[model samples]
Target: MSASISVIIPIYNGEQDLPGLIETLRSQTYPASCVEYLLVDNNSRDRTAEMLIAASEEMATQGITLRPLTEANIQSSYAARNTGIRAANSEILVFTDADCRPQPDWLTLLIEPFAKENIGLVAGEVVALPSQNLLEKYADCKDVLSQKHTINHPFCAYGQTANLAVRRQAFEQVGLFRPYLTTGGDADMCWRILQGTDWEIEFVPRAIVRHRHRATLEELRSQWKRYGCSNRYLHELHGVDLQRELKGKESLRRLARWVLKELPINTLKVATGKGSAVELLQTPLDLFSFNARTIGQREAKLPEKAKEIDRL
Candidate 1:
């Protein structure tokens, strides 16, 4: 028999994005009778709650169970996910963000690896949605949200929750995501599962989710800053070594080189219309991301207590 699945999404003021996700879910090729949608509202001040209620009513008749859950007290997406995880009624718990649109076969292919008893988690691919905006295009050029990036992490292979699926048993063994963690919970959970159990992580590239990239420069900076914060938390909890950005002299030398050489070359390329300006934007955008993360690491508050995995 096919495993039952629960799609858990964390929504925070997602009034604009939820409807599109609902349509995608409605069109899923997976058997609707075997799947449920748990849309967790993270105490949104917007119309997220109202939208979810309406979605629930709309999806009910289509044989897909849509539930509106609230994680009102905790202001973390991980916490909201935990609420959905606990409330989920299936053997497989699939996670995605509100700003993603899963392709029709996403759920089907994502859980396909579960047929292997040793597979603990399935990480689907995340591609930026089609965009004409320069910043969003830059994210696409870098494949910023690709599962391959995290799946090949130096410390350990993990998957972003943007397109991850975990078996209930594996989750049970490793416990739930750290409710207090605003970031890095996904990586932490994967590491714990790999170290604590015999199960393995699998990548499903065909299971794709079209994600909305950060549209503005500020949003882009904030994204990388949060990532830097995650890096710090992971280092504190698991002792993952800091990357080269913290090696003061090496970092300074690299910055000096960029300022002296690459910057002017790229600027000239854009000015002369030599090549794709979007391609040239990669280096500077990367630098911008790097600095944002570095600042985030420095500004991050270390957890006062040792990392403890939260469980039901």
Candidate 2:
């Protein structure tokens, strides 16, 4: 049976990359009649809304349906996604980021797994775009977006929203993404779909999207810090043990060692052209990410600390 698909993308300050994403979507192998494109603008101060509006008009002339929706009340991407889900007209709700560029057959392959009866979600692969610098190269070789690794460990399984699809019924059954969360919402959704029902999530490696990694150290640190904040929220919601997972002291120790010893050694090796550039770059980045995540987790817990002080 052929399935109709609604591709939903949540955008915020993505005007520069939106055109390329739209162009790639236009080139998809899936039939235009069976696919719908929904772009949700999350109150961008930039021209993302204008760009999407213009693209929609142009796409309509080509017999493609492109709808622009806005979720201005909330700033979270999950909230925007929920808006898209409610407005979607198809049985399969596919999600990808505005910064990601899908291959021509990405949609075709992503939806193919839905042909099976028990499959409720499809997690597609996300590959880093061609790296033009050391920071990008470090991200390219990292295990950041490996859905297969996550799926194999169901307890921690999470599909990156950048390349994921969910059946409409499964979403209805499991419920919408938590509106309060700005990050880790994809992981939260995957956990609920698996734990709340009998539905299975299949990983489709061939359904690929090229993602742009952070090109600078500051951007990379900011990204990890966001993840850290999300981690704290997830722990509170799920009653997961933060002390067990975070091991704050251990992280601090590692950060110290990396900053004091490994960083200098790697830097010297790189300077001498004896060390791998990716390794040299990745070590400090990883250390910074760890410390930043720890800090975020600590920050998220402050509200609880305030409550405790009030009780005292």
Candidate 3:
């Protein structure tokens, strides 16, 4: 039988988590013959290609086809995803990250909402995986990646690509994800789909995936910096002001106060067992994220600013 759904995952040095993800896919409740797995290797420098080759052989033995493709020219996950979308044969295109482990019913629930003719996109729920450290614990408590909060929000309302599904026709109409963006491309695509077409994006709480959060301070900082750069690019693309949104004297002052006074007091309370450690740790992380993003936004716009100066 032909596949009714195609699940696309983009990988770059994802060897650590690939095994579990493959196992999850193997055990999915959806019919194995009716699902096509497209794993795109975005020029991984590790054993990702080797692992996928082995996985393809194993999956084939179970009556499943795992197609491994390469997107070596570009280094962006969005570019890799676009490559997968173009190669997909199914009517429904589902997206998830390499580190995410979908529940057995994830595919079933993700595709169920498409039965409604007006629903063009489905944003599934993403819950943080079990935390192994303070940073991961803090991330879980903050639930920053949850799409439930994005529903009905005016300025931002979109599902993350880590657990999102889109109809093939609607996806093509929006022109797929922008290849240039290193981040925020998922939100950009959802926004274009909503604004450029008559279709609606629905949040399916039942379709769930367990995601692994940044396990260390360094990883967290790097993630936020990338997010910052991406936010700047997104603002430029949509004609919004990044400086006005992210950088201001008042914002800096508030961040300072939070870091110096409030964070210490909260940490003290947590140490004394009078407050939640997760909540307290989240404060500093938030400030760090803001500052990192501001720096990234400014850095990314340097070339553009130089051009403006030359023009003047």
The most accurate candidate by lDDT is: 1
Model 3 quality (TM-score): 0.87
lDDT, residue 206, model 3: 89
Q: For residues 236-286, write the lDDT of model 3, one tens digit per residue.
A: 766545644445676678778888888889888988998876767665577
Show where candidate 3 strays beyond 4 Å.
1-3, 241-272, 302-312
Candidate 2 TM-score over all chains jointly: 0.87
User: For residues 220-251, what per-residue lDDT tens digits would candidate 2 score against the true structure?
Assistant: 88887776776786676665455324466776
Clashes of each: 0, 0, 0
Q: Candidate 2 regions off by >4 Å?
A: 153-156, 241-275, 301-312
lDDT of 1 by residue, 119-236 (tens): 9899999988898999998888888889999989988899999999999999888899988887899999999999889989999999999998999999999998898888889998
> What lDDT would each prediction earn against the true structure?
0.89, 0.81, 0.82
Residue-level error in angstroms, candidate 2, position 173: 1.3
**TM-score of every candidate relative to the true structure:** 0.93, 0.87, 0.87
Pairs that collide, model 1: none
- The local lDDT score (0 to 100) that residue 303 gets in candidate 1 is 69
Clashing pairs in 3: none
Which candidate leads in TM-score?
A: 1
Query: How far out, in Å, is residue 10 in model 3?
Result: 0.8
